[model samples]
Target: MTEDTAAGNTEAPANPQVKMRVLGQFIRDMSFENVMAQKGIAGDVQPEISVQVNLDAKKRPVEHQFEVSIKLKLTSKAKGMEDVLFLCEIDYCGLFHVEGVPEDQLHPFLLIECPRMLFPFLRRIVSDITRDGGFPPVNLDSIDFVALYRNELMRRQAEQANKTEA
Candidate 1:
């Protein structure tokens, strides 16, 4: 019998201790538009707001380092009105030191864990920008990074399957 079998170590090796640290965090880009602020809209107006969140990650040439960014796009339009009230878009990025994570698990770690670490600051930025633009603060709902990552993987797999069929 193999040494592992003899030792009853049939299970996979224990996961390495993954370490992550935030080296830097900053707003890469941001814009807020108060479209109707100058038009004197009624005080009772209630605008419908929609926010989209996206996450992306890239490894740097340096070992155990990665850059993760979260992008948010917010659109606000008054009820029963076709014109937009405001549009806000921001790209927030963080430099991270990730170590002891396996290569196979790196993508998920970057897309899920790293962004999870960076999301709160990004959300606050969106909220503050909207408030500073003379509107009520737009508090972004908490994001489900795991769900987002799964959905992205499914989409990519479907696209690849379609390409292969073609």
Candidate 2:
């Protein structure tokens, strides 16, 4: 029996351990529309806000640099009515320097890890924009990137299955 096998260290040594750095971040686009003020709707009310997030990643022209971004769309409405208080959409992005991640796993890493780093800044931006646009600040809830990634994968699989069945 081989000594290495008996020692139970069967796995190959990992080369070029994972490395990542946030090179930079920026707001790609942002828009805030104050629907209530524009429509002249005013009343003491509670707001129901719905937030949607989408993530994207792409390789930059520079080697080892990638851009990862998240677009957040928030629609706020007065409670128990069809009145829109405000609509906000922001695309926030980060440039990352990454190395050592396997090619097969890069997509998930970009979509998940990069966005996790960018979300807090997005939350703060949302809060400020809401406050500035004359509504109470909207603090976003924490996002589960792992679950999101899994759900997206499942959705894509389902889409492929449907295409095949059709």
Candidate 3:
């Protein structure tokens, strides 16, 4: 084969390869202090949980990758009053296969795709937890992870720029 032909045949490595496996998943932390919540709300109450999602990624020494997640805080409050019923902080993570990936392309996949893949499971857990806690099942609205990721990146860049100028 000619050198030029050979060079043309070569393809760029796939970025952010995912060899995703559910390594081990459990309630990393759980609290069901329903008694206090019930006492706090002595009548029929509708509860709501506000969620904030965060995504982080890191490469391993070998081919593996880590997606560290903080699903933000979920605070359940009564429908009428401003009192909080319960609060939960769920921190979860996943191990991913990230091989044959270019350095430049890795960040987007980690920030966008990885979280998109993991969000459904996390959402299910939250819903189940709320239901089991005797409140109505909490169904969270779907998130636009790409937008969230881009905003976060922009915010970080702005912060860094401000710091540099300071």
Task: Identify the candidate with maximal lDDT.
Answer: 2
Q: Is candidate 1 or candidate 2 better by TM-score?
A: 2
Write candidate 3's Cα lDDT for 99-131 as tens digits.
Answer: 555667678877777767777887898788778
Query: Which 10 successive residues of model 1 have the least lDDT summed?
Result: 36-45
Model number with the top TM-score: 2
lDDT per residue for candidate 2 within 24-134, as digits (tens), equals 989989999999999998778899999898899999999889999999999998999999989999999999999999999999999999999998998999999999999
Model 3: lowest-lDDT 10 consecutive positions: 18-27
TM-score of each: 0.87, 0.91, 0.77
How would you order the candidates by lDDT, starting with the best? 2, 1, 3
Deviation from native of the Cα of residue 24 in model 3, angstroms: 5.0
How far is 127's C-alpha from truth in model 3 (Å)? 1.0
Residue runs of model 2 more than 4 Å from their true location after superposition: 1-11
Candidate 1 per-residue lDDT, tens place, 1-166, comes to 9899899889887878989999999989988878887576657678899888888899889888899999889999988888788999999999999999888989999999988888888878877898899889988888899999999999999999999999
lDDT of 3 at 156: 95
What ranges in model 1 sit over 4 Å off?
A: 1-14, 38-42
- Residue 7: error of model 2 in Å? 13
